[model samples]
Structures are given as C-alpha cells and as structure tokens.
Target chain A: MSLASLTKDWAATSYGFLDASAKRELRRKMLKAIAVPGCQMPYASREVPMARGWGTGGLQVTLTLVNPASTVKVIDQGADDGVNAASIRRFISRVSGAAETWDTLSASIVQSRHRVPEEVMREDQILVLQVPNPEPLRGVEPNMSIARQMHADADYGKLWLTLYEQIVRKGRIMQGAAYPSMVNGRHVMTPSPIPRWDVPKLNMAKHLTFLSAGREKRLFAVPPFTRVEPLVFSDRPYQVEEHAHLTCRRSGLSGYFMNEIPQDNGGSTFEVSDSNLGIKAIQKAEGAPTEIGETWYRDGEYSA
Target chain B: MLTVAPPDAIELRCNSTFQALMWALSRPGDARVMPEAGLAGIAETLVDLECTVFADTPDLREAVSASGALVTGDVSRADHVFLSSLENAADQIVQLRCGSPLYPDDGATLIVAARHAGQRLRLSGPGIEEPTEISLDAPPAFWAMRAMLCAYPEGFDCFFVDAGSVIGIPRSTKVEVL
Candidate 1:
C-alpha cells in the first residue's frame, strides 16, 4: 500500500490507556517542556507491561504527540524488529492499530534506539528517546547531594581533572560510553544514546526533540535552533571513530559499516551486514526475488 | 553477531540495557547501545542502521549473499554501528567511519556492550547543572586504551549498554576532569 494510506491507517490506533483528557494533559506537559527548552520536567509516565529500558518514555510521548494526522515508525538499534521495536509497534497496532512501518522518512512519530534512521528526519517529525539514568554526575560523585550541588553551581572542574588524570596516569582521556554533553548552551542533556552518528544529527535540526525516561520519570526537550555541545577537553581533544575499510561481507556490499565477523580457522574476524532494509539490495544481488514478509531462511526461524 | 547468551537472553540484555540508558541519557552527546552478540555484535553492530531484522533476515544464507537486495554489504558506511564490548571502544573510536567535518553528525553511532558499568571518568557538562560523574566498569583493557575521544566538533559518539540501562557522550560537548 502507498505510504500515505498506510500512515492514514496507523493514526486510527489508540495511544495506549491514556484517555483523551490524559492525552491532552500529556500534550500540555510536552508543550511546557518544549517551551522552556532544556529544563527537565517530571511527568506522569506510566509503567507499561514492557520493561523500564524498553522505551516506555518514548511510547508515552508518541501517544501524547500522535494524532489522526501522523504516521509512526519505531525502531530498536535502527531496525524495526529488534524485539523492543517490535513490542512498541505491536502495542501501537493493538491499541491504535495505526499503520506501522520501519520506513524513517514516512514516519511522523519515531521511537528509536541509539542510532537514527539512514533517512534524514525532517522538522515535521518528532523523535522520542528512551532514557534510563538522567544524571551525568551519578558516576562522578555517587552522591545525589554532591551531584545536585555540582549542577546547581556548575562546578565541573573535576571533569577536567578526570580527563587530565587519564592523560596524566595513562596518557589518555578516560570515558567510553555515556560521554557527557552540554544542552542548549546552558543545560547539559542526554541525546538519548542515538549513536554518535545520530548524535550530531541533533545539531541544528529543524525538528523539535523530546526525551523521556519512564523509569526515571523525567522528560526534557531540545527546541529548534538550540545549540547542543558534547563535552570535551582542549588538551585531550574530542574524536569520533573512522573506518579503515567500509565493506559488508554477507551481501558483498560497500558504503556500509561492517560488523567484524570471525575469519580465522576456528574463530573469525570483522565482517559487515546490511544496517537496515537491505532486502531490496539483497534480492537484486542474489536474484532471490522476494517481497516483504516472505521468509526464506533454511533455519526456519522466520515464517512471514 | 554471535551470541553466547541464548536468543532468549532477554534478562541479561535488560541489565546491560539499563546501564546503556544511563549513559545515553546522562550524556546527551554520547551514543550507547549494544547488541545481544559479543564481539560479533560489536564489529557488525553498525550494520543495524542500514540492515533489517526481518523474521528471516539473519538467515545466514540471506545475510552472506551479495544481492544488496535482501541484506548484504561491506562494513564501511553504516551510521548505526555496534561493538562487542566497551573494551573495544577505543579502537572503534578511531576506525568507525564518523562522518566528515561538514556532516559531523553523520558519524556512525557505536554500540559497546560490556560486562558491567565500570567506574571511570567524572563527566561534567551542560547536562549536569552543577557537576556530574559517570562510572564505567568496562574492562581495564578499555581503560588502558586512549581514554578521551571527545573533542570539540570531532569525535566518535558512544553508547555504553549494560544489562540495566544505557549512557551516552557525543563529541560536541566539553568535559572537565574532576
């Protein structure tokens, strides 16, 4: 079916247990978050049958933002069927029964993972991110009192010391994941682990962005035209990973990131696979002539 | 990606996922999300962006084909990248195909799954009004590598996914050592 019709169908679904009044309340709360921009506002986030880490925050926002005029696409790790994504899609389908898809561009409401879709999202789209921990200071001090005071006063000289310590003690900077960032030139906000590639996408985008944590029960927003800066030390320097070679193994494709597969005798090395929706390419390359939902695997896990 | 845990390793994934969520939410600028597979997941994780998890897409046969029609490719250009552990994050940082200066945001988002959230940097930036610290229990090998990847305007974004939640730190913000 055409995307337009599919989207039309998707909007018909309900937005979970939220009544019309509740939805309006959520809408009002979200607008409040957006209007203030960069401030955390606690909302009445519901506990879905799904777990805390499985996008309860995003689903709530989707319900609040979704309307008869929207098309929703939900993905986990950029793929629509990555368990969590499937759960959300199924939930929306069950409640709202709105047309659901993996297509990025076609979606007006998208709940995604650390990685954003390959298709660039437009301003019209509202991206909702799922969050677990909302505090950057938790790891640093382990004391909420200290952390709250640190932020209340902007006393981050220790962050520099930590990086310096990495360089001093080990000749390097010492952070791996959950790297810190400064949001809207004032408040530092988590960009919802949407991959570094997607991280920069948040820079100067036309769309309004929202982040929520059902478990934490905190919500924040990045209004249009706001500056989001990732944390960095001048002497240490900020850097993103670059590929020595970009090639996928299974599909014999290039211009795509490769997942290193073991290539040795007993073990192997790094290889690559399609990131998302490569079926179109696969069918063409292998003459596998197929369409969506046609399961052809020998292992027989998929039966669509 | 090879999975040591069963395909049903949902609980373990849950534990690490919360770690990941913390990092992602704490560090607005970083990327943290790991696949169920170990190293295989790490190396091939970025492929998730351009790849699909069809009911049968991982049919090893469908995966290894060169059709580009169903699902197949090289590991150079994916934006949604994955890593086996936060252990390999340092190297992944230097080699993950982060986008150019013009499209810096186009850099691949790397997912590094680890055994646990290690205690490491005390990160303070705009996210923390006063100050904030992040503890990563990534293996010492990870700590042994070049620690800092965040540089103003250029750096690999990261997501540290553990069992419970996720955490992130992109390359755009400034970090201070506590």
Candidate 2:
C-alpha cells in the first residue's frame, strides 16, 4: 500500500475527541467485554482532557459510542445538574455534537457515576457507569495479581467471609453501595457503587451496562438478560436503603430512592435522588404536559 | 464556544459499524444493519496495530495490513480471525484461540460470512431475555465444534455477517441446535 493512501489530512481535533486508533482499541475491548460478561478486560485507557479518576473511563466509552445522532445523558449520584454530571454532559455535547438531555427516557446513552436512573432502561439504551474500582476482590485481597487469580479461580470465599463478618458485627449486611454481585453465574463484579436499590435494576434487565475504571485500566460489561444477583446469605435476604417511605418535599413524589437533607429541628427532609424525575413530577403536578417513563420501583416496592 | 467537529467519512463509517456490531452482540441472535456491506468496515472499526488478525481472503489481509496490524497465517496466533466461508472450518475452529481462564480477553473473535437462513438453532445466555431461535447457513457440525471448544469465558466469540447484516454470538451465549 502507498504511504499516501494510509495518511489523511490534518484536522484540529479528531471527531468525538478520541483519535481513530483509540476508538478502534476501545471497540475491540468492548466486544471482548461483551463476549465474556462481567469479566474485566484491560485496555490502554487513553488520556482524555479530564482527570483519570473523575469519570474518565465512562467518558472514553461514551466518546467512542457518541455520534451526531446520539442523545447523551450524564448523571452523578442520580442528579443530572450536579457539577460533575453537568460538566460531563456539556463536554460530551460540545465535542461530539450529540444532543444533551436530562430526561432518562429520551437518552440513548446514559453515563452515570454511583447511580442508575430510576426509569427502566429500554433494550435500545446503553448505560455506561463510571467506576473508581473495577475489582470486587480489592477489598479482600490487596494484591491485584492475586485478586485476578482469585477471579480466575472464582474464589469468592473471602468476599462471603467479609459479608459474614459484617453480619456478626452489625447484625445486618452493612454494605450500602457497590455491593458485590455475580454476573451470569460466573463473575462477581462491583456494579459501580450504585445503591442496593439500583443493583436490582441490573438483574435480567433489558439494557446493556458497561462498568469502566480508568485509573485501574480495566473495563467490563453486563449484557441485557444477564443474571446479576447480589451476594446474600440464604437465611438473611438483601435489603435496599430505607428511602421508600420518604417523600420529596418539593415535588411531592414518594416511593423512590431519596436524598436526605438534615433539618435545623433535628428532623430530616427528603428529595428524590433522581432530580429529573422529581422535576417531571413537579411539572406534571403543575398541569404541564410531561412524559415520565415507567420506573423500576413503584409504591416503595422493587418492581421491574 | 466550541464548534463541534463533524465526523469525517471514515469516522462516520466506523462509528456506525461499531454501533451495529455492539448492538448485535448485546442482543445475540438479533440482526443489526451496518453502514456498509462486507468485512472491510468491521476491520476498519476494530482491528488496528495492536491486534494480530488472520483473514483467509487476500483482500481482507491487505486491508488488515494497511491498518498496520500483523496479518498472521496462524489462526491460533490471531486475536481476530476472518473467514469468507464457514464450510470445512472445523479444523480452523479447533485452532482458534479460546484464551486462558486467567485472561479470557485473549480469546479470538471469529468472523465468518454466512447466510442468515439455514440450520435452526436456539440461543440462550447473557444477551437473550428469552430463548430465541434463528436460522443460519452453517453446518450443525460447526455448532458442535463451538460447544466443544467454548468453556464459558474461555471460548472464542463469533460474528455471522450476511451482506449488510451481522449477528454476534458471544462465548457467553449458549447455542442449542434444534
């Protein structure tokens, strides 16, 4: 092949902010990640404008997937307007010319940190989760190589022991976020620090989920219909955060995960963690025509 | 104000090609349409200098080489293996790298040109919600070989391409012949 055929004209910046080779490498890793569900795949973890730990992994995946036609939504801890979420969303739109939205129903790709949207994601939608730690064995094993060996051996005895110890000490499973879950009965993966409430939404769900940790330089995926069972003892069942009874003070919405706000009178006020969902509830209450998609939870109950 | 750069033709093609391939694999047995026909777009979208690929066709080898990837003749050494046809592919399938249990990502990706209709098979696994059946123009022996070779995370993945349509059968997917 001629050198001229391989070369292209210089551009100020590559489309989607990632060079073609980086995208190609991600594409290859992603396919492999999908092939072996929940198994962590190592990647080059190309440098982005943002810092490594702050959603860089999710940003790289989203950038690889984004195009002009893609409608992107980014959230940090269930809020769309948080500084991290807003900046990520704006940066994605600015670089890729993709449509930005706060509504979960309208988004084709949702890049999230520590939360999954309350709305049930469709098969067409993809969820990219920003992960600080991709290794579930990191807590039990300090050495990464040993942890990988444990993963290969499917040796989760230590993880179960940790949970067992927590039960003996706290009388309940005190693991709040990033509860370890087994995917496809093969690999135990941390579902990216999402709450126990959000973890159930991933089990046998319709949407594809990618959990990526930039600092760790690893990525994994959970395809639709895969079994994501939270590790729980048979006698003691899994429990979500006790936010079901609380109501959002502003929107009058209840029966969903809520963010508790401490009050002056030693009381607490609650707001729906999904900010856009609360906003839509407020709009609908005000007689404004709004479309809120069906959610995974209903009436203080976990229902798909 | 930042003016977003419009995707060039190559970028657009790779983006769409990857989209199709991603969704196709995400929901195994579902056919997704690519922006362009044939294996060239797939090669452009995924294979690069980091990969070692084995393409049976001369044109595909040239295309892969142009992409600066090592075009290997050994199927076992290839991370990506492309075959124009699956007929009499039992030997090659045997040689395809299934990767080690420690590093399953080393498993080869086998892309074959096969018709969408032929032998009826049921697929059940990670991507499939309910057990779904599809017809493919491949010998039942191929499925048997795949079943024999694939040991969960250790098995190679496959893509069946027919003109503009592609279907992915990841190793996580269990293929049952009817």
Candidate 3:
C-alpha cells in the first residue's frame, strides 16, 4: 500500500550472505531437486565472495541452509584444514553465525569438495557436495539438451558403452572419481567428484546429500534411503579404490580411504583421507578421551 | 575485518520455514512444523519478485502481489499455486505445470490446505527407507487425479499445509491410497 511496504530495511550484508530473493530461488530449486532425486535443477547461481569454481555452489547451499543454530563443516578432499575448506568454513560461520566444527559427527550440515566422511552420517544431517561437472553424459553427449533428452528417456546406452569400453581397454572399471550413478532407480547423476569409496555411502544412507555445481549452474539431490547404483556391467562388478588395506602413517588408522603420498624414491606412503578422523585417532591414542562415532567402513570393509 | 549481518525476523522465519519444507519433501509423509500456520509463511518464504504466483483466495493473491510476484490469473502460467482445499482442486490440478523433463524445476509447487488426519496413504520412494503410512485429508479422487497428471520427471511438487505443520509429497514419491 505504501512505498515503505515494498522494501526491506537495508542491512550491511544480507543474512547468510545471500539476498532474500536468492535464498527464495534456491529454496524453490532445492525443493524440486529433493522432489526428483538425482535430477539436476537449474538455479541462478549467485555471486559470493569466493570464486565460481571454489565450492561456490556448495557454499550457496550451505549459506541458504545455515542459521545461528546450524553446526557447519567444510572439507576439501576429506581434510577440514585444507585452504579451501577452512576458508569456506570460516566464511559460512562469519556470514550466518553458525557453529563450525571439523568433526563430522558434530556437524549438522557438511559441505565438501570431495569425500563423504568416514563416519556414518545420521538421518538428520545434510551433506552438500561441490561438483565440478554435474552432467554424467558430458563425456558422451556434449550437447546438454540432448543429454537431458537422454535422461528423460532413460536412454543410458552411451553410459553403458563408456563402461564397456573401459572394460575392453583397461581390464577394469577405471572411473576413479565422479562415477555415474543411478538414483532412486530413475535418474543417473554424477555423484560429484567423490571417489568410488564414497559413492556407496550415498546409497540408501540415512543422510540427505545435495550435489551442486556453481559454474555449471545446476544442482541435484540424493534423498535419504534412495538407491545410488554405480554404473557397472554385471559381469565386471564395481570396484572401489584399494585403499582399505593401507594404514595412515601419521594416525596409525587403517581400513579407510587413504591419500597416497608419493615418496622421493619411487615408493608411496599412505595417510587417512579424512583429516579429522585421523586427528581423533591420534588424540585417542595419546590417552585423551575422545568420542569416535561408528564409521561407514569397518576393518577395511564397507559393511553399511 | 567485515561484520556479518545478523538475521532479521523475516530472514529467520523464512529460513526456518524453508527448512521445514525441505525436510518435509526430503522425507515424504513426514509432517514438519512450520514457523506459522497456514500458507502465509510459505508464501513469505518462497514467493518474491522473481516468481509467478496463482492463488484461489483473494487474501493469498493479495499477499503474493504484495511480495512483488506476478499474480497470474491462469494456473498454467503460475509457478506457485496456493489453494484453500484439494477437494475442489481438480480444475487447478489439471492446469498446474508439470514442467518438462529437461527442466523439472519449472514444475509448479502446489500448496493446498488439508487436515493432518484423514484417509491413510502408503508412501515409498526416494525419501522413505521403507514404505511409510501417513494420513492426510486429501481425497482418493484427488490422488487419482494426481496420478493421472504426474508423469515422473514431469510433475508438480506438492505441499499439504495444516495449521503449522506441512507434509511434502514430491513427484518421486509413489503414494497408495489405503
């Protein structure tokens, strides 16, 4: 009815660092993404203080979800102390006044460039993954429109062919990261760039996962209890990276995904990928009382 | 060096409302409490100048207009539709945008007022670990009509709001009338 009614009071910065409209738009898209699991939903990727490719998509989602009550965690390649992860964590906490934590168990929302935590995510928690490329068909079908059509038709022959070719050439499925996966038995989505070990953590897990790519300007979700089947021939069988046997030289933790550090003399050393888990392992070994939640993997086997 | 902006009342309310709606949709058949009763909180949380809204009631239409969203008379043109009841929503349901397969986000979000208790439904899909049963006031005819209208990856998402609680049934959810 009046000029003042149409506008809001100007703030130094919008809460969560996104304008109200941006949040509304994201809210709408996020709901749709959740509605149709693994289906990519396009949103107006808004600008943040960070670069477009540096977890901006995940950051936006985190910012939209963050509140004073939220406990946030950000990780890059499984380490919370990595520059990108730490900066993003700090940024999220600064903008929203949300609590920040490295421990996956304490985090209500976990945003990561790659890697799901070694610890199992609860039903109430949300995982936000930063995707470099959202389109699984990008390798075969460069045209996004045709790729979308293929998704609509559930025509994933090319995807199968890609796997078949890998079997023919490499004698094993060589997709190390960003494996194409079927969600809810309907749509196939690139489960971000998470390694094969992390893919199973998404399947029918009790946690909600959102994969967003800011540069791509798209987002998708894997709701709790949804099926996330990695593409593989029934004859070949799917294989995760063989890091389960390796132990972390630093934390003495074994049976989890490990980062291979190349030694100067042509050998390789291994360390636990999830830095916080390793930290907790070291602390518990040092006779400190620390609680370690049950993990997705146990004694080198992903029993969950 | 920079000071973060504290969440104002509006931000806090919308953020919480979206959280409720998000969880409601993520776990279909689960009732999540809203910040306030009715569809006003939903409209405030989602509708803005960027949206095109359709509402059956004058109050909601006024509210949408006040939010600076385009108030479309036609249901097909609106991205968000607000209805007082689903019993008489057959006409609107038919015209609601299901969106294209390529752009399912274009699908309209249907918000209807329904009681928390009524006919029971069995829900199984992405969100449900096992088929979960829930009761909603929506009639069998309404669901039948919904099944007719929705073709996966090409259907509108729904939110049933009762007082301060909401239950979301995304298109991915397979609902059986029990």
Candidate 4:
C-alpha cells in the first residue's frame, strides 16, 4: 500500500476531541462491556484535558458518542448547575457542537456523577455514570487480582458479611451510597455512588447504563431490562434514604430525594436534589410554559 | 472563542454506524438501520490496527486490511470475524473464540450476512424486557450450536447484517428456537 493511503490530511484537532482510533477502541470495549453485562472490561483510558478522576471516564464515553445532532446533559450529585456538571456540559457542547440541556427528558445522553435522574429514562436514552471506583469488592478485598478471581467465581460472601456486620453493630444496614448490586444474577457492581433512593431506579429500567472508572481503567454496563438487585438480607428489607416525607422548600414539591441544608437554629431544611426538577416546578407555578416528565417516584413512594 | 471543528465524512459515517450498532446490541432482537448496506461500514467503525479480524470473503478481508487491522485466516485468533454467509460454517463456528472468564472482552465479535426473515426464535436475557420472538435466516442448528458454545460472560457476541439493517444478539442473550 502507498504511504498516502495510510495517512489522512492534517487537521488542528480531531472531531469530538478524540481521534478516530481512540473512538474505535472505545467502541470495541463498549460493545464487549454490553455483551457481558456488569462485567468490567479494561480499556486504554486515554488522557483528556481534564484530570483522571474527575469525570474523565464519562467524558471520554460522552465524547465518543457525541455528534452535532446529540443533545447532551451532565449532572453532578443530582444537580445540573454544579461546577463540575456545568463545566463538563459546556466542554462537550463546545468541542462537539452538540446541544446542551438541563432537562433529563430532552437529553439523548446524560453523563452523570453520583445520581440517576428522578425521571424515568426511556429506552432510547443512554446514562453514562462517572465512577470513582468500579469494583464492589474493593472494600472487602484490597488486592485487585484476587478480587477479579472472586468475581470470576461469583464469590460475594465477604460483601454480605460486611453488610451483616454493619447490621449487628448499627441495628440496620449502614451502607448509604454506592451499594453493591448483583447484575443479571451474576456480577456484583457498585452503581457509582448513587444514593440508595436512586439505586432502585436502575433495576429493570428502560435505559442503558454505563459505569466507567477512568482512573481504574475499567468500564461496565447494565443493559435495559437487566436485574440490578441490591444486596439485602431476607429478614430486613432494603431501605432508601428517608427523604420521601421531606419537601423542597423553594418549589413546594415533595416525595423526591432531597438535599438537606443545615441551619444555625439546630434544624435543617430540605431542597430537591435534582435541581432541574425544582426549577421546572417553579416555572410551571409562575405560569411559564414548561413541561415536566413523569417521575419514577410518586407521593414519596418508589412506584416505577 | 475557539471554533469547533466539524465532523468529517468518515466521522459522521462511523458515528451513525456505531449508534445503530450500539442500540441494536443494547436491545437485542431489535433491528436497527445502518448508514451503509454492507460489512465495510462496520469494519471502518470498529476495527483498527489494534484488532485482528477474520473475514470470510476476500473483498471484506481487503477492506479490513485497508483499515490497518491484521486480517487473519484463522478464526480462533480473530477478535472480530466477518462472514459473507453462514451456509456450512459448522467448523468455523466451533473454532470461534469464546474468551476466558477472567477476561471476557477477548471474546470474538461475529458478524455475518443473514436475512431478517425465516425461522422464529425467542430471545430473553439482559436486553429483553419480555421474551421477544423474531425471525432470522439462520438455521435452528446454528442456535443449538450457539447454546452449546456460549456459557454466559464467556461467549462471543453476534451481529447479523441484511442490506442496511443489522441485529445484534449479545452473549448475554438466551436464544431459543421455536
């Protein structure tokens, strides 16, 4: 083959901020990740402008999937206006020319950290979660090689033991976020530090979820309709963060997950953690034309 | 302000092709339309110098080689295998790489040319909300062979291409002949 055939014309920067070969590599790994649901697949984890731990994995996946036609949304800790979320959203839109949106219903791809949207995601939408640690066995087993062997053997007894110990000591399961969940009845995965309330939203849901850890250089997926059962005992049922009775002080919306603001008067007030949902509710109350999609929870109950 | 670089023709094609392939694999048994009507677009979208591909047809082999991938005659060594047809592929199917449990990503991705109509098969697994039935040109023997070879996380994934349409059945999918 001629040398000219091997090379392409020079350009300042590659489209979507990632070279074609990088995207191709990610595509291969992503397909494999989906093929074996919740099984971690190792990738090159190429460097981007941002640091490795701060949503780099999600950014890479987003960049690979983004195009001019895509509408992108980025959220940090369930808030679209967080510094990290806003920066990522703007960066993706700036590099790929994709439209940015805060509303979950309108986004084609949502790159999130620590939370799934309160609204039910459709089949067409993809959720890319920024994972700080993808391994569910890390807390119990420090060594990764043995941990991988345990995963191969589907041995998750230590995780259950830890939960049992917590129950014996605290009288309840103390695990708050990033609960270890069994996917497709085989692999146990950390759903990426999302709250207990949000974890149920992933169980047999319509959307495809990708949990990627850039620093760890691993990625996994939970395909639509896949079972994501949180580890719980037979006697004690799984408990969400008791935010069902809490109400958002600003929007007057209640029954969703809330963020508590500590007051100097030895009390705390609650606001909806999903900032866009509160904004939409306030706008609708103000008589502005706004559309709020159906949520997964209703009347402080996990309905969907 | 810096002006964003627009996507080139190849970028657009690969993007759309991957989108179709991604959604197809995400929801197994669903037919997704591709931008182009052949295996060539898929090769361009997935394989590169990092991959070893096995293509049954000489035309597809040449196309894969042009993309700088190591085109191989041995199916077991290939991470991606493209078959123009699956008429008498018993031996090849047996030799297809189903990766080890430790590193399941090493499993091969089998892409074959097959019609979307024929014998009905039921698919149920991670992707399917309910057990869905669809017709494919592959024989029942093929499904039986697949069931014998695949052992969940350690089996190969597949893509069946027909003109501009493609359907993906991942290793996680359980396919039953009707």
lDDT of each: 0.51, 0.94, 0.93, 0.94
lDDT of 3 by residue, B1-178 (tens): 7787899999999999999999999999999998899998999999999989999999999888998999998999999999999867788888999998777778899999999898999999888988999999998988897898889988989999999999999999999999
Model 1 chain A TM-score equals 0.77
Q: Of the candidates shown, which would achieve the greatest DockQ relative to the real structure?
A: 2
Candidate 4 C-alpha lDDT tens digits along A197-300: 99889999999998899999999999889999999999999999998899899999999999999999999999999999999999999999999999999998
True contacts kept of each: 0.00, 0.92, 0.94, 0.81
Candidate 1 is graded, for docking, as incorrect
Assess the local accuracy of residue A255 in candidate 2 as a C-alpha lDDT between 0 and 100.
96
RMSD of 4: 0.8
lDDT by residue (A259-299, candidate 3, tens digit) is 99999999999999999999999999999999999999999
Error of 3 at A92 (Å): 0.9
Q: List each candidate's DockQ score.
A: 0.01, 0.91, 0.88, 0.87
Better of 1 and 4 by lDDT: 4
lDDT string, candidate 1, A1-304, tens digits: 3456323232332344454334533543453354334545567777566788778888887765544345788877656767778878767655544567666656777777665554456645767877776666665789866765565455666665665777788765555444566765655566766543355556555555778878777787775445666677665556433333444555544443334566558754443332454544566677765443221121211111
**Candidate 4 docking band:** high
Name model 2 segments beyond 4 Å from true.
none
RMSD, each candidate, Å? 24.2, 0.8, 0.9, 0.8
lDDT of 2 by residue, A56-120 (tens): 99999999999999999999989999999999999999999999999999999999999999999
